[model samples]
Target: MNILIKSATLPDGTRADLAIADGVFVESAGSGATVIDADGLQALPGLVDLHTHLREPGFEQSETVLTGSRAAAAGGFTAVFAMANTSPVQDTAGVVEQVWSLGEQHGYVTVRPIGAVTIGLAGERLSEIGAMARSRAAVRVFSDDGKCVHDALLMRRALEYVSTFDGVVAQHAQEPRLTEGAQMNEGPLASELGLAGWPAVAEESIIARDVLLADAVGARLHVCHVSTAGSVEIVRWAKARGIQVTAEVTPHHLLLTEQLASGYDARFKVNPPLRRDEDVAALRAALADGTIDIVATDHAPHPVESKEAAWAEASFGMVGLESALSVVQSAMVDTGLLGWSDVARVLSSAPAAIGRLAGYDTPFAVGAPAHLTLVDPSARSVFSVDHLHGRSVNSPYLGRELPGRVVTTIHRGVPTVLDGVLRDPQEVSRG
Candidate 1:
């Protein structure tokens, strides 16, 4: 199929007409192409999420690749790196290939599976890192995301092992000992609310240690969902020294603060729990300055029952894929801290570079993959369950007004979304 997108504003503030045919951009539209009037919209490279939890092959109650991919499409993403915290865990070549195959069949978004750093995520022994990397999925990233790779010696060994294949170890930087039984961010509010506190140092301590380890071994390391001011400073220091370290900040961390915890609403409960206002400020600044390499959703979704529990017993995640771009626009672009080009770098280009996903950084050029998103920048809406395309209804932005609704998303020359509505792939296939 061929498509013509007319009068769209590029991220660099230039207006142009874009054409796609047979899944690649072209100089002009082919005959009988589907014409779309993209006037008053901004065209951006399709987003790529480095951290997304598509709970399949085990926790289908929460989300599956098919459902999660729809959520990603709704959020204007062309690709997302699925985290390895699934049933049986994505620790082997077979599991990674299964996930990769599911993504291909869905066709909603490209799903790259991240292999687990340790077998069973036990942090004791390394998994089949080389085999997974060499598998059909071509896994280029390994992580123990829900659980930290706590043992120092084991972490170092895993880092060195992946360096052999140019793979990066994305560590979930939390010290288990310090955060045991923690419920919310450690502070005066936690004490007043009578909930357990998760200290910032718990996350900061592990990040500091891992950055040094990465420098010592000359291995690539990626920090996931960095949530503290201290952690930001550490990452900045490592980068200044030319350490091969890249970091990601979640949308929740950028827009929401620990103050939301006062209501005891379980929807706000998240891993490495939301930090203070100062931490949010630091994260925004770091992202704008290029100290933080990318903006990852950490798009964890839980079932209704799982999230409805008491704060102490609730799950530690929120559905984020569908609302990531709007949150970024509200938090970064609308505030004048970043422009559209910066959003493209953090959301699309930089993440692609870090994950080593080919052909994504060259967006909207001739012969490149025709993966792009069209946004109505002036459109504003109150986010509600109607906007959610996933199985889970645990979005943190529910009831919050967000800017810049995604008008359309084209993946490989196919329209997954049009006119703010998601297209059913089955219906399109039948046509």
Candidate 2:
């Protein structure tokens, strides 16, 4: 599919014409090209998500690779790293390869399978990391995301094992002991609501321990869903010490607070539960100053029954892939804390670098793969379930008004979404 986009604003705020041909950017679209007038739209490098839960090979009721890929494309992402906590757990080479093959077959977005740090995520023994790394999937990131790698020795061993293959361990920094039976962020609010508190130290302590372990072994470490101010400070300190660590903050953590839990709305409930307003402020500041590496959608989706239960019995996640960019724009860009270039960095290139996915270093370069999204920044509307393209509508931004709308998203030279509408899956597959 050949495409020519005219008058689109680049990340650096420059207006230019972009021509795509044969799955790569070219000097011209040549003959019989589809021309799109991109006036008043921003053309950004395709976004990449480091943390996403596509529950396939087991829990299709929640989300499948194809449905999740459609959600990702609707949200302006061209690639996403599927978490390891699937039904069967993505621990072995065969499972990872299966996921890779599914992504290829669907062709909605690049689905890079994240291998598990421990077998079945039990945290007892290390999984077949080497085989998965060398498999067709070539898994570069291993994690026990839904559960923390709480054992220090096991954590160290996992880090060392992945470092041998130049892979990084993305840790879910939650101390199991401190967060047992916890429901919301630990504070006065939790006490008043008669719920167990998930203390900040639970997250901070694990991070503090892992950064030192990573330093001792000289292995790369990545922290997932950092939600507190203390966690931010610890990551900042680690980076200052020149430790090889990268951290991600989810969109919910940046824009929402634990106060929303007062209503017992399970949609606001998430792992490493939302913290105080001060923590949100600190997270925004850290992201602006580069203390936080990137914005990742911990895009967890669950069935209506799972989320409609009591607060304590409800699932710990929110569907985020459909609302990540709008939330980022509201929390970071609209606040003057970040620019479009910074957005491109946090949402695209930086995450691609972390996952070791290439073709993003020189965005929109001639002959580069045509992976990009066109967004209308001036558009504003109340977010509703209609915006969600996934199977489950468990989003937290349902009634909120958000800035920016994805106008068109092209992945590998094919239009997954165009003119603000998601293309039919069969059409995308054919293209």
**Tens-digit per-residue lDDT, 1-431, candidate 1:** 78999999999999999999978999998789889999999999999999999998799999999999999999999999999999989999999999999999989888999999999999999999999999999999999999999999999999999899899999999999999999999999999999999999999999999999999999999999999989999999999999999999999999999999999999999997998999999999999898899999999989999999888889999999999999999999999989999998999999999999987878899999999999998999999999999999998899999998999998888889998889865566456
Which pairs of residues have clashing backbones in candidate 1?
none
Count clashing residue pairs per candidate: 0, 0
lDDT tens readout by residue for model 2, 1-431 = 78999999999999999999889999999988999999999999999999999999799999999999999999999999999998789999999999999998898899999999999999999999999999999999999999999999999998899889789999999999999999999999999999999999999999999999999999999999999999999999999999999999999999999999999999989998989999999999999999999999999999999999999999999999989999999999999999999999999999999999988889899989899999999999999999998989889898899999999999988888999999864585466
- State each model's CA lDDT, in order: 0.94, 0.94
CA-only RMSD, every prediction: 0.9, 0.9
Span of ten consecutive residues with least summed lDDT in model 1: 422-431
- Model 2: how far residue 156 lies from native, Å: 0.7
